[model samples]
Target: MGPELPAALRAAVEALLEGASRKDLARRSAQVSNTYRGGGSSATAIVEDADATAYVLSRLPATYAAVAAALDEVRVAAPDFAPASLLDAGAGPGGASWAALEAWPRIAEARLLDASPVFLETARRLAAAGPAALAGAEMRRGDLTQPGEGWRAADLVVTSYALAEIPSERLEAAVRGLWAACAGVLVIVEPGTPAGTARVLAARELAMREGAMVLAPCAHQQACPLAAPDWCHFAQRLPRGRDHRLAKGADAPFEDEKHAYVALARPDVCRAAPAARVLSPPRAGKPGLEFRLCTPGGIERRFVARRDRAAYAAHRRLRWGDRVEDA
Candidate 1:
């Protein structure tokens, strides 16, 4: 509980639920009969929006915890980074942005860029609700493909679950441009799917090329689960009537499907080459362990030996160059 967090924030949520019964929220949402069905919001995306908000609001106290953790990881990796303002890409109804704000109170101003007017309106409403700092935010209508001058200014940048939607050709360039604009840090989040994983991989590569470092989910390269025909989406369940039945219909307990990508931005920082050193035999009853290569990047990257053979082979283990796990 940060001292800056207002007491009204909790009060508002409590009041919001008081008027709309959780059961009603669930029933209407489940029925797939929202009044906004024929409206401009994407049929596929509204349920997503409803379920996402409901789930985050329901159980995840400070649902931004994951986002905050990612940001903290970045802070640990790069202690000199800080931001007074932010530019958020694909600011889907401002959910992740709010999460980021919770993690980084140092940011006082923000600008949300997205292609949806409905999303912008929702962002406005959410901002007005309790996050007083959000009052400094403004919305933009374009994206990486045709972003206007409005997208170019910021101390921090965030691309949360918005990059995969961008065309393949523009992905790298967009990442570079985003880093180029960052005065402090950049955080990118996608889903845990194969396609999402692939996009995250590409983003990591692009970020490294531009001098940024990986701060979380340390494994940058991983197998994509969605590369095949199988579905690769995560589900977030929403309880009944805890949501806006007018917006969600009778679908009491609904589920939100999503792919996520979370990454951090820093000035191009690279780890040094691995130091080559010989290992000594263990004493007494200690199990024989050998072939440990240390890197100048400062991580005790260890390798288990198999009959004097290391799983990673006899190689220089750079801090991050050696693929150990997912980031």
Candidate 2:
């Protein structure tokens, strides 16, 4: 089973679905999916309350699972780091904020910013039934691509699956702005595709140029060694609720959300860079195991033979997203 939704959040979404027509929701969900697939902006696609609710029902679980998984990596990279304030940029239904709060309970203040009023309103409604910190979170409506004055600097800043919507020309500026508002760490997550990987790569370069240190996914600050046709991404499986199934018009009991993300911390923050990160699932054969990893040196394929009991046993425990020191 994947990460379960909190009881209050589950109830809140259920309540929203009570009066909603399944057929209407399914139609809207399809439209939203089509719009996204066609490269349209979600800020414009999700305009109505029903549209926003449909989006949450169909996308929230997977998004939350993805963000939560990424945040887990952040926790591992910076075990002693805790942020009291968080700024969730382009926070659609506040899934990133929810995940951030779960990862760092010390987050006492949260600010959620989005350009869509309906998304902001729905986020507020859903958060009202969640933890106190998130329930009392400040919701602000603004275009993330544009620099604004109302937003405050935070210890942690995160943007999940939001940068893809910004025009390519504005993405650099937006990323810089988010980094400027981050006093400690900045995390950005995007869909697991070539385009998404490209966006993350761009952000990674920008963060490095700003004197930020790599905190996750990458073990070194050197240029990404992966060439074209090979991009970095990870997957998280999440259980699908009845409402989720209905909204998505699918019978599957679970969903796997694949994403590409990077977590960068300011130099002042204490964080240890992993020696390597597993890039693919370890393949076990009669002879031994084959592991594909991204290390400080570059991409490497290591083979551990069955004769090497100690190394083989250790590599057996490794997963695709796991960080290893010497494997």
Best by TM-score: 2
For residues 1-327, could you state the per-residue lDDT of candidate 2 as single tens digits?
468776777888888888888889989999999999899997668989999998988998888888888888888889888999999999998988988988897799999999989999999999998777899999998888786963579999999989999998999989889999999999999999999999999999998898989998898888899998989998888898887888888898998888999999998888865769889778989999988899888899999999999988888888888888874
How high is the lDDT of residue 114 in model 1?
Answer: 77
Each candidate structure's TM-score, on Cα atoms with residue i matched to residue i, is 0.59, 0.97
Cα lDDT tens digits, model 1, 206-321, are 77776666554442323322234542222233333334333444354443334344454554533222222222111222333333222233324354444454632433232221
Model 2: clashing residue pairs? none
Model 1 vs truth, CA RMSD? 9.8
- Every candidate's lDDT: 0.52, 0.88
Give the worst 10-residue stretch by lDDT in candidate 2. 143-152
lDDT of 2 at 136: 95
Which 10 successive residues of model 1 have the least lDDT summed?
A: 276-285
* lDDT (Cα) of model 2: 0.88
The local lDDT score (0 to 100) that residue 271 gets in candidate 2 is 84
TM-score of 2: 0.97
